[model samples]
Target: MSRLYLGIDGGQSSTKALIAKESGRIIGHGRAGPCNHVRTCQGRAKFFEAVSGSVNAACNQAGIDASTVTFAAVCLGFSGGPEDKEAHSRELIRSTKYKITHDAEIALSGATAGQPGIITIAGTGSMVFGRNAAKKTARAGGWGYVFGDEGGAFDLTRRALRAALQFEEGWGRPTVLRAVLLESTGARDANDLLHRFYTP
Candidate 1:
């Protein structure tokens, strides 16, 4: 039997798991819901349950049991960092023989792969992380849903909303986005505009 190593990259909206050989060639993979244990679960025990579900789901997808893995590592990049989420981190460790660290750090490691460079991520949130050749790492943005993440989908939606209002008031030039937006949002009239926020 070949030895397998599991690697997980957790995010705010999803979790990705990769099962690979010790030589680092990926073999199996799986994904699940957001891994923000603290925010998703109201308490510690509940958070552990969610983590267990994620780990088991991944293992099941790979046709293996969690205990059978020769080695494993989990990267947790969520809204909250590990320093403030020690309890949740501990719970995850208790469930698997894996090294757990912040998700951003994992991204950095993969992006550079022992080299030095900058990596910018734009997803539900935005973050710019970089490291110098000498191993000095730095990060900017990733302040969460509020305070920052200005160029992400959420921020883009805010601008769209403003544009919609502007077009409605006849203060701005008409845009093709208005029709696409209105159709997707199912806004029958002005009264239905309130539903746009919930649509996408």
Candidate 2:
């Protein structure tokens, strides 16, 4: 019998699964859309669909049956914190013998490869993580866009909207973004602009 190892990196917009042989060689990789925690504004059904799709795609790519996975492990880096993680992990365990943890932990494990170091991740979102020489770990940021995650994509988008509005009210100087936004929205004047904001 053959064994397979699975690694999952769950994100807000997508989930990536890496299937590797017992010898540590990657055999297949698969991806599906958004696997954020179900408890954080989104419900369980959406979360489950995303995860199941990713896992099934991965298994199919590896040409292995879900039941044939002998020594499977999964790492989930989802948006919500411990509570959400526990629930998702439970779901995975009920279905398979995969180990589960935050997606960041898997990234750290890969970056440091079991060593100790600091890692800064800046993608659609941003987060700073550090592991001390003694292996004590800490995270500096990653609060999501609503409360934290300053300079993140959502944060940047919010800032852009604010800037656009400020310029429109003559409270700020005109900028390229303002012109671009007005042109794109086809707003000839403020009266027209009111209707253009957020129609899409």
Candidate 3:
């Protein structure tokens, strides 16, 4: 039997899995929905779905039975911090070794090819991470959608909505953003759009 390895990138938008051989030849790839939340029952369900869906898909593509195969190593990089997710992952994957970490670390490793440098990721959220020659590392600004995540997609959308609300309420200068947002979202006004955002 050949030794197999697995790598998964679990992000806010989606999750991807790759299965490779000991020789670094990629044998399979799969993709599924997001798995960034695990604080609630519904969130944990979604997390399980995303991780299992992607891993099973990859195993199938590689012509391997996931239940019977123990990977030599597995690495999963998640969009949110990995503190709450390690145990959940352990229950699902059988691996000799595991490297569970935040998405930014993997992104920096890939971007710099394991060199000492910095990388900024701006997707659903925003964060910056770096490593120095001394092997020290530092990170900033991955506080998520509620508190931080400045310059992220959610932040930009919030700013646009706030502007539209101000315009509709006659408290701020008029701009075409109000009309554009309303047309794009099919909202009668900024207030309606805001309500829709809160509705699931």
Candidate 4:
């Protein structure tokens, strides 16, 4: 009998899955919708959908039915912290063993290939992780856009919007962002933009 392993990344933007042999040779790959915990904290249906969808696609890509194959181990890297609650999602797929953790851990391991190195990730979220020569690991940031998310696009956009508003009020430096935002959003003036931002 041959054994297979599954690695999945349920990220903010998309979900990805890869099935491989014990020797690390990949056999199948798949993609699905967003499973970002930060965005779906109110419920877990979307999260489960993302994982199940990707896993099924990956099994199909391997020319097999998901119900017919059992992975030796399944690792799911999710886009949120406190993965303990995800244990309930295990039965959503078939695996002899299953584990779930934050996506950044998977990112670091892939970046270093089991070696010592540091990784800085910035997308819808931001974080920095590092592993030392002695294999000691440490992490910083990743508190979400509302709290820290310094380098994330959301944070950058918020800054730009604030600056644009300030310039309109004649209390900040001039920037072309104000003109561009007006053109893109079809706002009649800076006040219209401000009203839109505050109301919606």
Candidate 5:
């Protein structure tokens, strides 16, 4: 039997799984919903669903029995740091060697092909990670959606909403952003949209 490897990227927006052979040929791929948070009960459930669903789907595509197959090696990169997720991943995956790491590290590795370099990721969240030729590493941003994430999608949306809110209160100049936001979100007004966002 050929040795199989698994690579997973669990991000704020989605989870993706890829199955490859020892010769570095990709055989299967799968995607599922987000698995960034695992603190709350709902978050844990979402994590489990996303990881298992994507891995299983990939296994099926690779013509392997998910429950019985043991990967030679498995690496999982998660958006919200990997410290809190390693144990949960171990429960769901069967592998001889496992690497659970931050999503930024994997992004950097992929972008530079394992060479010493820097990478900036701006998905639902934003972060910059770099590895020096001396093997030192550094990172910035990725402070979640509230305090940081300056160039992220969520941050941009928050700024747009704030502008609309200000316009609605008559404290700011009139702009087409207000109308566009309301139309896109199907909100009656900026205040209504804010309420909806806070509700869910």
Candidate 6:
């Protein structure tokens, strides 16, 4: 029997799974929702659901049932680095030959093809990580949703919103972003943003 392998990349925003043969040829791929453990049971359940759903989807894409596909090895590169959670991993897969690590580890490996190089990831969050020729590694950013991720989309959006509000209140210079944001959100005026943004 030609064995199959599974590789998962789970992150705060989404999860991806790939199935390949022993020869390293990718046969199937799938995607699922965010797997980040956010709150108690719900968090864990979401993570597990993403993992299982991704794996099964990949299997289905390859025209096989997940139960019939025996994996020789399973590797999970997940977000949140070393604190991704081992218990959830155990519940996600039943493979003995399995390993789990931070999502950035795989990102770096793929970006450099196991060679030495630097990689800066900018998405929902932003991070800079690198590996030297001698195998030394270092990282900057990934400092949670608040203090870090300086150049991420979420941060930029919030800043734009703030800028718009400030401009409307005559505290900042006028800019087109204010109009664009208001038009997009359908806010009647700048004062309405305050209530909408903080209504919760």
Candidate 6 lDDT over residue span 25-122, tens digit each? 99899899987744534877888889888998898898778875568898888766646466666666666587777778789998889999988877
Model 3 CA deviation exceeding 4 Å by range? none
lDDT of 4 by residue, 1-200 (tens): 56999999877778999999888889889899977673445437777788788988988898768877878998888776645535655667678787887778888888888789988888777888888999898988887777787887768878889899898889989999899889888889988987877782
**By descending TM-score, how would the candidates be arranged?**
5, 3, 6, 4, 2, 1
Question: Which digits, one per residue and each the tens of the lDDT, describe model 2 over residues 114-179?
Answer: 788877766556677778778898986777666676766767766776787788888977767667
After superposition on all C-alphas, the RMSD of every candidate to the true structure, in Å, is 3.6, 3.2, 1.4, 2.9, 1.3, 2.5
Regarding TM-score, does 1 or 2 come out ahead? 2
Where does candidate 2 stray beyond 4 Å? Answer: 67-71, 92-99, 182-200
Ranking by lDDT: 5, 3, 4, 6, 2, 1
Candidates 3 and 6: which is better by TM-score? 3
Clashing pairs in 1: 76-103, 77-103
| Top TM-score model | 5
Stronger candidate by TM-score (4 vs 6): 6
Q: For candidate 2, what is the lDDT?
A: 0.68
Q: If scored against the real structure, what TM-score would every candidate get?
A: 0.76, 0.81, 0.94, 0.84, 0.95, 0.87
Per-residue CA lDDT of model 1 for 76-121, tens digit only, reads 5444455446566554543345455666667878877868888887
In terms of lDDT, which candidate is strongest? Answer: 5
Clashes of 3: 0
How displaced is residue 67 in candidate 5, in Å?
0.9
**lDDT tens per residue, model 5, 130-165:** 999988999999878877899899999988888878
* Ten-residue region with minimum lDDT total, candidate 5: 35-44
> Going through the candidates in order, what is the number of backbone clashes in each?
2, 2, 0, 0, 0, 0
What is the RMSD, in Å, between candidate 4 and the native fold over all Cα? 2.9
Tally clashing residue pairs in candidate 4: 0
Cα lDDT tens digits, model 3, 1-200, are 78999999988888999999999999989889987778854888888899999999999999999888899999999987786888999889999999999998988888888899999988888999999988799999998898888998889988888887788888978878889988998998667888889997
